[model samples]
Target: MKPSDLDPVVDALEAELRPYRDSHHTYRRLPSGGRDRREILDEMRELASREEAKWRAGYSSGAVYHGSADHIEFLNEVYAVNSQSNPLHPELWPSAVKYEAEVVAMTATMLGGGEEGVPTVCGTVTSGGTESILLAMRTYRDRARAERGVAEPEIVVPVSAHAAFDKAAHYFGMRLVPVPVGADWRADVAAAEDAVTKQTVALVASAPGFPHGVIDPVEELSELARRKGIGCHVDGCLGGFVLPWAERLGYPVPPFDFRLPGVTSMSADTHKFGYAAKGSSVVLYRSSELRRYQYYKTATWMGGLYYSPTFAGSRPGAISAEAWAAMLAFGEEGYTIATKALLETAAVIRAGIERIPELRVLGDPLWVIAFASEEIDVYAVMDQMSARGWNLNGLQHPPAAHICVTLRHAQPGVAQRFVADLEASVADVRHMPGSQGVMAPIYGMTGAVKTRGTVEELLARYGDLQFKA
Candidate 1:
């Protein structure tokens, strides 16, 4: 069947799931005029149990990190201890300030902040990686407007940078100049240099971009931005915690942090490889002066003085506390051990994928391994793996799938199972002639479509189904 034919099937499946979408924990008034907490708790627990398996067994990619029972319990305890704390009212919860400050400091140090005379790098705790990236972009935008009088600002970014950069550009009203990546999947520094103009506010480089897991040439790109008198934002959300330890473990890591003189700001997610609980990340600036541009303050408000360091006000202090606890609990030694396991597991997976006859690994990656096949449909293989109870990330432009090795994948027999299953999947695809799985057809249509508007409309319909309940 054609790819568009499967759209009806997908729409039907979405409609089927609509009834259960928002009915997971519906609150109804009781005859006794009180809610039933026990029933609600049971429903919530059931939902969690039903959804935990794929990620729990390490079949998924980079979603849940450090799923150990002890680690989760420790983080839960920390969060429970500070459940009532709010950073907005620092006087009420002084501990929030301490945790927030320490989290930023520890994250900065890990990302090569205080190595040299870097002037005690400062930052604020953000909600997540998107906020961190958004705040950095907004800071550059405002700083350029104030200092350089750049009204119509433009941000030079590699095509492989995170989608959040595009979100930042839209939110801050800045023009985004996307520089194409080279054959190696790294950003083209010369292309970025050519894209920059007087209205250019900042340049962006990613340390191991999300799609292909290739790091941009930060040293060259940042220097280009610096010479052009524009800001450079290094997106280390993926590699910030892992790469530092990977470098110390003697991996070939490029210079992609504040260590580069031209790197003015960076976004790193503590929730990711840092092993913190979700909803926590840090955005660091080269100096407090640059950070001030990211802050919001108003004295003319009807309510007294109001200020927010990052995007959100009255943020979840519990998540911040959990992030701090995770970092402190897993100090440098702990991170080093985790990083070693992750890198070693990634190496094993990479080698196994390379051994497969039909498949080729994309670029040279540490943990995130993207592989494509020349003999069989890669999406068909992905569907086969999915049927076998595995969840992997699908990539386009080259039609590949990736398995982001996390601690779960490092478990005994997990890597071997992945390789064995992948081999079986490829064999199945080779033998099954003219076969296209559900996603294969979809991806095929996506590739062949000339108008993106139709695809976007389909996406919007999918979103509507998600909220149909």
Candidate 2:
């Protein structure tokens, strides 16, 4: 739809959703007139109860990895214990340093770092996956500018790579060159090699990309970058905590980590699969020299010499402690068992999807699977699922949907419930001839538009809706 057409649709949506939006608590500033603490806590608990079922019952995708009540309680306790600790002042809070350092070390070791006298494979804890990716991209841009004298640096990334890479390119003043994936939904190594030029600073590949959950051919892409004397970044944000354990459980996992000779940096999210509280991830570098480019140090400041390793100065030490506690609590054995259950559950879902004649799985994914329907409109199917209390992710371009299986899905009958709901949804969508569901029009608009500006404007308006009250 054109801009003029979109205004009416948006107005209609706002009118329909205004009641629910008004009651939802987007922020809770200290109760002005002094409400009881117990009352406030109860209100928050009620909100959580309202939002928990979609994720806890395995109807949602990839938001909560380990959603057990006991695990959350333990992590919350860990966070409470270190709530006052600050890593910026190590002298004051030595425990914060210990937690942050150990979190990085453990994450690095999992991702094939510190294997062969690699100087302990140094890194720093960041806010989340986006910061980790941003730091690595900035490091490559700075390294290329200093060593290769490439002023206008560019980074070649697969079309399946995370949006964070594009954000990094925009923030760091580097050109982002996106190469398309092949029919199998993996990055095209030949196209990536063709896209690289003298100005290219790095090549990026995801262990298991977010959109379709297919692992890129990192070995081939990184080797190409190596031959061209540029950096190679392996994005293991979604897979870093699962792939190693999956490989140990006899899954056919590929080489997409520091074990590859061409991989110079990597980003891994502790908050996602590490079962930690949100706001923690690690960014590892092959060498201290390369990581130095990611640091910020200035000596001539009036506030005394200022230097920070990651993006933030005074980071949340509590989240760092929670991440450390999670890693140590769930040792190698704990992770292996969790990964095994997750993959087994995913297999069940995958098999069920394949049995349905209307839909087909995208790729040979382990835990995260994307499926598309050749017979029916997938978005309408997604809408049907949503009506049945399922919150699945919607994909464009090829018009597909995905569900990232977690430990919650491994519960007794969650997988069976998902399959039943999916079958029913497909049948409902098929029966409702020419029904344009809620999200169908939006997805259609996105896929049919030639210029992205219209889509971006719609997204901006969508963002504006969040602040309506």
Task: Find the candidate with the highest lDDT and give its number.
Answer: 2
Q: Clashes in model 1: which pairs?
A: none
Compared with the true structure, the alpha-carbon lDDT of candidate 1 equals 0.86
- In the range 2-22, model 1's lDDT, one tens digit per residue, is 447447657655744654556
**Model 1: how large is the Cα RMSD against the reference?**
2.5
Minimal lDDT window, size 10, model 2: 441-450
Off by over 4 Å in 2: 7-32, 115-120, 443-451
- Tens-digit lDDT track of model 2 for 399-424: 88899888889999999999999999
| TM values, all candidates | 0.94, 0.95
TM value for model 2:
0.95
| Candidate 1 displacement at residue 278 in angstroms | 0.7
Q: Assess each prediction's global lDDT (C-alpha) against the native.
A: 0.86, 0.87
Clash totals, every prediction = 0, 0
